[model samples]
Target: MGAGGDAEEGVELEAVREDEPMTDLDMSRACVESCVRFREGTLKSSHVFASVSCPILHKLEEALFCFTANTTEDASILSSKNATPVVLPFLVRFVDFDNKVFLEFHQIMTDRKFRTGKQLCTEGKLEEGLKLMKEAVDINPTKAEFRGHRAYWLQENGQFDEAKKEALTVLIKLNPSYLMAYQVYYNSCLLTGDVRGMQDAILRMKSCPGRVTKSRCKIEENEQILMILKEFCVRLTDLEKTKNFYEILKICKEALKIAPYSNEILVKKGIALFGLKRFAESVEAFKEIPSYSTSFRLLDIMSKAEYLSLKFPPAMEYNRQAIDLLNEAAPERKNLIKFRESMAAISEEIKEVLIAMQNKDWKSMQERAANTKNLINSGSYKNERLKLQMMNFEAGAFVQQKKLDEAFVLVNEVLSAWDTNYEALSILVDINITVGKYHDALTDLERLKGMKKGVDDQMVDRRILEAKTKQQEMKHATEPPTRFLNLYTMLKLPVGATDSEIRSQYRNLSRTYHPDKTRHLSEAEQNDANNRLLKIQTAYGILSDPGRRNNYDKGLAALESRNKTDSKNGLVIRLEENRKKYPKVFGLASSSEEGIPSGSSATPTTAPSPESTVTSKKRVQQEDGVISPDKVKRFKAN
Candidate 1:
């Protein structure tokens, strides 16, 4: 049977949930954790999620209803209704988003809140846990954890197709280093009675070759990885064999010590940690993931960890980050951990500080260099681009704070990269134009045209026109042009312009400036048209013929290069070198191969096969360290 047909037999888009009561924490923390795994680039977690399409779609229908119900809130930021724990459940649902939301949603996501939200998912409320995970993913679609959980929940609920797709998307985002995603994906298929997916996963895992790590294996470490692999192999060797959670834990501990950050090893770590009783450590270990972060696993493990220790620092840290991240989350998408832990962190005074900090408006530029330096120094972001944007923000803040010199310094720093940024160029351009520096403005406009993409073309044109008008006003007006001027003007063909585009440009120019049509032209108008007509004629004459244009361009380039070289005052010295490359042609053969002298060998040997001919010929031609074909023949002849 075909793959799709076989998969059809395995399951349709059925909404099935395990009858056993899922952990209450499942919705909050687990869902968010899965999204992280998704963002971190796990595919299996996404694949397993495909199994819950019906439930996921149903949840989306509800989120849509929630979105439409709120009248005053921005469509960009949806708020949640607090009837049931919709945040966890809704977030865990499968949603379609392109793979490019990585940096765009940074302002909306918090790593801490995501962790706590996932803890709630693990508390046996599998349905609710999944929803929150799904929401976290919705807010920060770039996160791997959220997507992974969505996949896990879907697969558990029998939506394998959706789970598999989610897995693939995560893999694409994260690349193929994510073995955990594949593992979960295999489990999703295997759990749903489709053994083929598991087998396929195994095949893919093998064909890709010795784990993505550099093969710098100390024999002991290699043996340890092998041992761990063998232990995990038992899970598949006999699907019916009951696995001891402690034994699995022991195996992961040894493997982790050897390759602490290996994705495959980490995946093995997660599987083993799942069954261990020290659920908090296990959660931390899982959270310290290298690949395939399942939001479901994060939540399931997180809830268990919270139960293990409600006031743990890791859990608290999780809440804090989640709060910051959820700003961009959909309404009703709050994490329980974030909500409660954040309440604990906020005293009335701290809340006041947050409120006070929001009020800032500045018109004057910064004046202090120290203010600029201090502002830049305070930023802790590792990403270079983000650091730059934050610098801009700091500069703006300093300006509002009445630090003029600081603002200028900061703005100057920006100008270092974007010297002619309109925001910055306005400073110089306005000053130059006000002082009647028409040449400066024209020079600036000329340079601006050569800039990379995203330049404001219209703004450039306006500046150019102003510069030209100033130039005209400064110079005396020329008399009218003669009627004898050619219709074609000076032609400069664009780079890579096809023959068709060139022809079209030429035709358009030809029709516009024909002199007979300008019988009613004023003196200035006639002069302007006549000049344009001359340029058109020049352009057409130079570009219309292919050979002429090519030769002209080539010659011009050569002349320009020669002028540059001459200006540099460079020196050249010639050296005589033997031309050994033409051995026979130059009448210079090696001493050993000058002629056959006193032959030694007469027996002939069979010729080598074509593949070895080069090697055989070289072997026969050696005289001492050098190759001498004639010497070799005489030696063999004797």
Candidate 2:
């Protein structure tokens, strides 16, 4: 041996001599030192030494063996223990070893589970996929990615509520700025029709407090949100065709959550609410549109809603604003001008009706009510609430004039068509009281009180007391009249009849009641024939227009729901009464199979307004600051 070999041998002999005297504790400590050096790459596995066997030393040896052999599973298990007892001081010296091992194992298991879950979901095994996804999340609770996967699958499984809850967990607990979680939540809310939840999700995405951390591409994030809103806008147009005003409003609310100032969504929302007869809410939706908007459609719709809501000043202001925005050559300009004229006429007639009622002039009240009806029936005006008001006023006039039969007929028809019309119900109660039918009066009064809960309590109570007192003197009780004279009934068509069926039936009825056909009858009969023709024309006007027909259908549904005991028997009775009263006019003998009245030609026409009488489409452009025809055309083309 060389001198170097001899020197190494002498050192090993001395180390063995030193190791021989080491205690079990000392051996454990020495083993831990060896393990640390091995982990730090400062010592080779072959050179590592242990002098004696001990529990702690054994653990350290096992851990080092697994680490060297690349058996991460066993190493991870060994690390998850009290290092000072299990692996002596090895893990304590490498303080991050246990954590690092745990993290690696967690990542491996979570990835395996997540990938398996995704595959399962893609294979349509939702329940199994969901389980695996949940397990993945459990294995790595701090990672938002696992939770987001679980949430999306849950939504696909139709577990919307659970999906949203899981998504919230990611957004709130794991990752406050997680974008995927927000998208999952939004989709869940949308499918479930949770409007407020969808809105919240949209708002959160748009204004995420930690968006910088959540997304790398801000433009992509914004495009995603805008895409959602665009989808809602497209849905609104389809919903309009269905006349599902409620659904349209919900979609608008959701879209507005992402873009609160979207003019298109707001206008659609306003129109939907207006169609629903929610005039106040419609006005509120319209008001959200920026006042600087020059949209003619927006202003026109807002004006109509405001007018029906009885906000006359604002209604007129909106109309004038819309007019100022239009040119004389615009087709809508003519319609708008006619609309403004009709509004003015209706307003004047309403005031006159009120004044007549105040003055106890039944004739004047009836005439003004008739004028309002004529204006509404003219097709240029379209105020739903105003039409109801005029009907109530007309009935009130008949009641005050002591024409009880006429009053009864009108009130019954109105109530049957609009059972929740408090004004018509009140008029019916008045008629009952005027005829000394206290029982009927009491019944109507109680119904009114219930419907008007928390309103005019004192007035309702006084009326109830009077009705009860008068009941003691009543010896007879007759069924308060109920009649169903809906638009369908007026045209003598089935409830589910098609538009063509409606037109054909309308033509048939018009021909039967046309003055030219009924001219051979007596003068009284001819007058009755004219009245029937007018009613048929009004019915056609309502049923022909899709929007008006939808509103009427909705009203009919509400009426049926409110008056659950409504009977077709009442309609049969009313029809019989009509035949008895106007035998020569309504009887079979009066029916004529003569020519059909020209549908459009027979349509009632009002005298041309001063604005419409202008033969020249050209007007002074400077007046009202009206844009020129050419400019208006160009602006509209955009």
Candidate 3:
């Protein structure tokens, strides 16, 4: 062989000698080194790990680690920049023949990758580290660290279920010896609203302060959850979803024990009492926060309470006050989402009531009564509601009080504003019949019948009877020849007649009347004849005297007016004229006429004070800028 060939064979023989000494530890180390190199390449791709040095620096680092690992100080300083690199020296320290070296090498390789993943995690590069950790878990199933990292990533993304499963798997696989995954599992439980899990986690946290303390809780998070639960309970209470009042009250009482200062609880109590028909107690409960919570609802309920008290003027007064207060309390004009609906409903009811009274509107009244059925059953407006619902009560009251126009005005509002209200129809019925509007009465009655459902048929029949009675009364006032009314009769009989002719005619008529005229005939006949003769004589006198005739004609023209309809306007006019024409005759010729009205009772005829006859619309002068009933009181002073 040549010299060059001999040199090459000598190197090949030395390499074979080196391979002959390779042990099982050396083979395991080779496997670990291969894995570590792959991890380093991944770390370099991940930005989690620093770049590998230039070839010169890399060879220098390897030599330094090999030479200094025996001294702990050099090794510790070397680990400051990169903790994972320390695993290399720990592995290198074991002899090549030692079987423990391979296990140590695997640990160091796993730990280095893990340490790099943690640094990346702190910098918010979670997905990259999570990918590596998942792969590591597959490779090393018993390592809880890999599973813990995956669970943490899921928790960050709000994937609590997956995170919880992973954490549980890590705990199970680690045999409960390693407690690292306990906190992450607890956090997942909390996010899922598992209180029992939270308690267990909290206890574990307390056991190891350092571990548990790292699991941070946002401030007041617990209280916030409690607050949400409280509101949910309150809404349920308001809905009355419980079986009944007692059940709802119990629910409220239980909630109150948890939050005693709850305003919602107090309002709920008031509502419960109202539902139970305890008006006085309900009012007391509602009054608890009149100013605290300004709303039309409180006023509406309060008004209902007062109306149920059965005292009339107070009921009206309270209702008026409630309407006014609601107006003021509303957030906007016409924004009465609830109360306006109520007013609109009640407006129709009032109209039906008045119509029932007028035309004897039975069906309308019954319908109105039905509309108020719930209110009555609950005892909302007991007496006032009952009174308004009576047969023709409101209409009769209006007529008696000489407030016909006001009554009509109110009924008109009910018809035009309220929606197809039977209550309004009933009211109009009673009013029309009472006011002698037979045609109006008839129309409303028919309309009421057409709309009738569950009607009181007896009430309808009664209305028809009352309507006939009203028709008769109106006929008596207008019928041409039923009885002799002074001028009305005299004019009907003859154009002209002198006083003597009238008196002579009267005497002859009296004898012809017989017992009927002078209690010598049937009572009906006597009433009929006496009425005829007296009217004839009065009419003759009115036509005979020129002044009386002229005055009578004027009153006859005014018969369609209010005063002329009830009283004899001609008679009042003559009385007025007589007093003016002959004051002395009317006053009895007083000698000292002091404080006497011209035709008044025989008192003095002079002024008590000149201001007494000031004749202004307002009699009292402005006294200290106050205007009141005191003004009338001043005038009525002795």
Candidate 4:
């Protein structure tokens, strides 16, 4: 009988009796028929096909879930224990047919929903797409492909936690051999910062019997790197405590061979190098740390390395970050609090000395510089670089106070120890300039150009030109022309002011000259205020752009050279007097080529008659040299 007819009668295969010797085809037909009855809710829980082997019944029990039995009672009924070898081949045949039917049914439904959902996602309807994708996953819960799409969209929707769960619980379980599920899991873990989960995914993928060879290789490489990190990263502290820096360095070298960009190992390497008294190499190692990996230990080690390298500002910042991390982690720890206070005091002293130098508070700068020097010498730091820095600052103070001999001595001493010391070189150059030793200033500038590590080639060239110009000025006793309205002068800033200083000065001047602040003044005063504000805006526009500012500086230098030439020739270049009266001819035109002085009328006083044109040409030719034929013809035509 057909399975549909049997299902209609609610018979649980009682018609197929055990005493009947059934063929393989008959037994296969019986199981599928019984499963169909269970799916339709017509099969009684106590009903069984007695002639079918137990293996056939077991296959039916497994297929019942895929077929979706009507109730849990129906599922439990299909769980049979009786077995016989006679129907085993028939049981395998039955399972293949059932799986084909199940796959064909689910594939059609799942593909339709998945394709439509992906189309919606491509069109940017993410919510609708996600809902349809969920429906597809629900239709085929065992299909890895369907669930992988859902997990990806969830990740795109920023539901990272949900995406991670879907990938780990469903996709990976369904298809552990494929790369797609593991890739989705690893990427989701990255966004959530679940680093350990990411490592787990990579490790699992390393053993996956994946079809993609490239992915498998990459996974194996990553697993090797993880192994190295786990081993070396943990031993860093113990090795450092034991002062076995050579061992630490050896571990770092081996680990770096496997994972060159690993930040943790790099930090440990820097610490080891620091402990080994390799300060320069330690600084190099510390510089490789990415911004995201600036942990407390990295910052603390970097602070010590930089301080020993004689970079005070960077050391201060690094120490401050370490202290801030400590404050956040455990503020009540007595040792940490004491350490924070001590480091903060040292930073404060350095900061005050810098501030004093910037303000040109000579006495205060000298005193603070001395205090910081004493602190460095007496405290744990016995760095010669710090001593050089102090000497450089003291030289700067002395130069500001016009104590040239002492300033020169101090700066020269700093240069003797560290010839490439930028601050000391700057002070020595300034001292040379003050003492009218232009030759020495030029020599210092050449030395600066030779040490090209941090030098801006353009800036060094400009400074060299400036030193030469100053030397020429001193030799000729000729002053630089100060009459022009330069941007620096308009903004009331020094010539070599930094970008931050320019921005700050612009804001202050803008507020000072804003029209709202000048509303109560006279109309003339208001007009002057408007002009000043416009000038301020124009100056800021040119100064804020690096390219434009560089060009403007070149223009200023050219103007200085021109002014010096004029002074040497005893020739005064004056502004035209008739700029407003004769705006086009005498003011804008080249008067020197036209042989027209400032006060002379450029346009003829009256339109010369044709008869007077000839006489005018003669009078012009006799008074001047040769008259242009075009001018005579134009006069005649007029």
Candidate 5:
């Protein structure tokens, strides 16, 4: 007979034998057919499936075969009575002609068991879940879905290697396109530091051509992609924390390819680049983020990159924006305070540099620049722009000190690295002008003008004019006469003055032009006096010692002959002019009929006669008691 005639005959026989209870075999067969009919939507409005109030049916109706069947107690009873084996044949008979039905049955059973295991896991019964999941996998050894669940439980319980093996079995041996299996495999690779394996799994899942026909599996494909990207982001964060910037950047790029518009991933990529000292690239990465995204972290990183790149104005603007966004963002963000403090410190450093530049404090500027460079080198600061600014500042200081070669080297280094650096270019132009390299200065100024977006073009134009004027004036002039002053001219003395004479003049001039003596004068007058006092001290120091004086006389003679200039004539003119300008300082009288002192015939200065010196000594002895050696000896003997 056909299967339909056999079913009808069986039903008729059951009705005829109503007085006798149905055998376990009969009940199992009936229950299996009922489940199949119900799944097919042909059977309806029946509470009892096989002469028993089955809770599994109720659970299936409520959870739609997605959750665990809360019938473990009944299942245990059935298993203990050896009823599963009797039921197994009926299950096979109902699904024998339809592989779809068999697949659905296995899927439902696997999902139920996996849900039960997950519940146990949530209830602090991890070991119980592990054992139950293992049993589920053993029952359906060929089902990739069940093995994927088992792999997850294994990973949760710290059996990473075993989890990886199980996941690989599911993906490679059973179902190559299983999305859940790929997730498990990816996570296992991540935890074990197998980055290559993780990457391979990501590529495999991405390239999956939808082998699994289930709608749920198709939905899981997108979900698995998201999960993998999130996992990579987490790993990137961990790597960044350990300062593994290169690895972080690599992972960030990999994740970016999956979700190109993901703001979180882009932010992380920019941060990694910033950590790697790739400031320009880092800024470009951050710029990929959409304008509407309210991410303080993104703004902060962009500001830092700009600052390091030496774009101070923009860096400050970005910093303000970041701070404002942080205030408007979630108040519970843990890094808010720390980020603010860091920004504040950077702002302070920039302010100090700006102030020094404005005041033209070359020495202070140089010192601060050194300190900023140290901070950058030590990784305390990550602003490349700040480092460039510091280099420019030091070069400016060198220019002020007339260290042209050193200044040129540093300025060129900055310009080569960042051609658009306005400050560095400006300083380079100034150095060129100072060294009479007018053509070079004009070239730099032209470059600067071309790149001057927000800067004062008028100021640059004026500088250009000044450079042209100086260049023209140089053609007519005799190479700009160098002002070389000898020690005698500096101290207002003749070149051949003796040591005692130089010392006497130095004492008088120092007291007269001292800063303390000029305190009552105007600020300009006081500054002039201070400068003069410094020059006088330097000249006196050079001409005070006999050895130094001898060397100075020789150098002075050589310099005078080289230039064909008589500085002694200039010294005499300065002495006469000073005698009129400050009469009390240079009004010492001279005797013309007296002879010059011994050992100073080169100076040609006349003094009072020898009788005048004896009379002055006798007067000093009468005023202050003078004791002879004979008188002292007689008194001691007494």
Candidate 6:
């Protein structure tokens, strides 16, 4: 053997020598020397003296070397492999073994590995940290510290069953007094849905000595868990209060991952689905809870889902179940009376809606629907589907009353709120057609056809075709008339009438068709008379002005020239000749009076002579009270 091997073998032999009893200090010094020699590569495992001193000393030397080096990787390997399995017992039997030194060395090695694993965990390398922690527990199976660490890592990694096992081992087998172990156990119980286990852990923690005077790792962990639980509870309560169902559903789903079998979480999920009007989904969520675990709130939600799905019988059955649960509930339960009243009101409203539907009494349906909506707004009811159904019924009542404009407005609101609603769409289509909004009707019909499930396509197509046909007919009927109406035709006058004659004609027509003259007529007739009277007044106003009359005459002359090929042109010529023959009647001024305005009267210089007067009387008598045309001509000649 080499000098180094000789020296290591002699030390092992000296440790086994029974004649010289070593004190605790002597043993500690020897262990420290062995660790230094092992690091210097002088202590070889192959140079074995005996199993008793060699195995224990060899492991202790290696553990102490790793601890003194403070190499996390080497320490982890030593602890994980349980390199000191026999070291404790060997020390206990040794003459100079120091328990304090043994504990210190083990602690140093364990701490190095633990800190490394914890670093890995802090860095979000949970799987690697879990592996390291598991190795730590394997190395020191009797240390609650190592087991508690492993349990925490397991719980964090979502290995609740494994974490619970590790925590139980620490609390039950390794060290029953470890407060951190109880904390880990409680957390595991919470994650694994073991309520009783969590309560037991909490009690043990509270009963722990120095819990208040001394700060403990477990207390910090417990507070962290409490803060998390409180935050979740507050968030859920706020979501429920605000009726934010979608967000509530998401939050509940996350909560379920933490406590998969939690009845409270499942009930909250069911209620959120119900709020979203996902009745079937809500029912499925509710079904996850066992009957024995079901509460009045859960039962009520289930009943509401069935009710909204139009399964009235099942709804009623669920409501009965809820009532039974309520009756069996403790009398001191908060909100018990309020809950019972709400349930009864729901049952009553359901009956009313069903009856109204059965009788097809739209008015009654509307009233019931309105009441249900009010109940929902008042927070007595919480069914969005029911509220939508009530709105549909109210819209239908408007349709039944033939208040189509009102119906249109109401149905539009319903469709805006729930675009996929078939009844609302159908009602909207009907309203559109009734009010001559064919384009809108067609648009709604197309949308309805595209729906996954909706009104009959054939019926809708028929309505579309009818709407198209009516639209075309309306276009044709509303086209402007082909005949042209001139000013003369509008006033019912001859083409060459004088200004005075036009005025006279307008007065007669206006009186005949005046608004007051048609006051006793129907509205339509009164409107028509007013329109005609307005036209007559407008035409008279245009022709009464000289400037406008000249412009109108020019337009009329142009029109006459354009129509010269027709017989109407000959009638126009004859009317012009009659104007020339009766110049005075047509308001034509003579050449001598050209400077005088037409409306001014020409006063006679002297009164009619006595002979002229007697002659006019004789002429009127001779002509049977009518003046002769030759006598009026002779008087003008004289």
Best by lDDT: 2
Q: Residue 633 in candidate 3 has what lDDT?
A: 40
Top TM-score prediction, candidate number: 2
Off by over 4 Å in 1: 1-319, 322-364, 368-373, 381-413, 418-422, 446-456, 475-638
| lDDT of candidate 1 over 289-311, digit per residue (tens) | 53323343344345434423322
Better candidate by TM-score, 4 or 6: 6
Task: Report how far residue 537 has shifted in candidate 4, in Å.
Answer: 81
Residue-level error in angstroms, candidate 2, position 94: 74
lDDT score, residue 539, model 3?
A: 59
Across 1-638, the per-residue lDDT of candidate 6 in tens digits comes to 33345445544433446777665445544654553344356764333222224334445646554444544443346656455643332222232333444445555555656666878988899987777666666666787777887788877877777887888887667766676667667777776556566657766676655554225535556555655655666899987776777778888888777777666778788887766556778889988876523566676667666755645455556766666665545652334345446645754674675577668887787788778777755644454545665676677776786655455556555554455566677777776555444555666677667453333588878988987876565444334334555778789888788988998898899889977788899999998888888778888888888899898889878766655534334333443553454233224222222121121122121234423433332111111111123322332332
Report the C-alpha lDDT of model 2 over 318-356, residue by residue, as the tens digit: 888888898989889888888888777776776777778
Candidate 2 segments exceeding 4 Å error: 1-227, 475-638
lDDT of 6 at 261: 61
User: How many residue-pair clashes does candidate 2 contain?
Assistant: 0
Of candidates 6 and 4, the better by lDDT: 4
Better of 3 and 5 by TM-score: 5
Candidate 1 has a TM-score of: 0.23
lDDT of 3 by residue, 1-638 (tens): 32233224432221224547544334333433433443345323223213222222232233334433443445455556343342444333322323332344344445655665666766788876766566556646777777777788767756666787887786565634335466567666654445455555545444543443434432246445455545646565565863356555556566555544345565676676555545566666666543423554665666555444322233344445555655555663234333334433444454555556456654555455455444443442233333333322343345445444444444444344222345546666665554444545655666566454555667866787777775565445544443324464443444345566656765675566545437767778778877776666665666667798778666655643543455434433443554464343334323222122221122221222422322222222211211123422432231
lDDT of 5 by residue, 370-432 (tens): 776666655434444456666877787877776655666676666555555666677767765
Taken over the whole model, the C-alpha lDDT of each candidate is 0.44, 0.64, 0.49, 0.62, 0.60, 0.60
Clashing pairs in 6: none
User: What TM-score fits each model?
Assistant: 0.23, 0.41, 0.25, 0.37, 0.30, 0.38
